[model samples]
Target: MIVATGDYHVLTDILVILERWTICHRRYHHCATSLRLKCTEL
Candidate 1:
């Protein structure tokens, strides 16, 4: 993979953004599922 310094920084920024989104998405899904289960049980 040919990566210049500018491209590297851009890629790093994208990766960081993606990682943040993934963490938030997982947390949201987990909370939503848990709430659904609790509500169903109640």
Candidate 2:
């Protein structure tokens, strides 16, 4: 039972980390695109 609980916690932590990583990556991509567009305009 203890082993199962530990495994579950690990899985949850991994999922949370993956979600945060994906969100941050998307934000970075958006910021980069906007900066490129502004530079082109100038």
Write down the TM-score of every candidate.
Answer: 0.57, 0.58
Candidate 1 lDDT score relative to the true structure: 0.67
Off by over 4 Å in 2: 1-3, 30-42
Candidate 2 global lDDT: 0.65
Cand. 1 TM to true fold? 0.57
Candidate 1, RMSD to the unseen true structure: 9.6
TM-score of 2: 0.58
In order, the Cα lDDT scores of the candidates are: 0.67, 0.65
Alpha-carbon shift of residue 19 in model 2 (angstroms): 0.2
For model 2, residues 1-42, the per-residue Cα lDDT tens digits are 356888999999889877766666655655776654544342
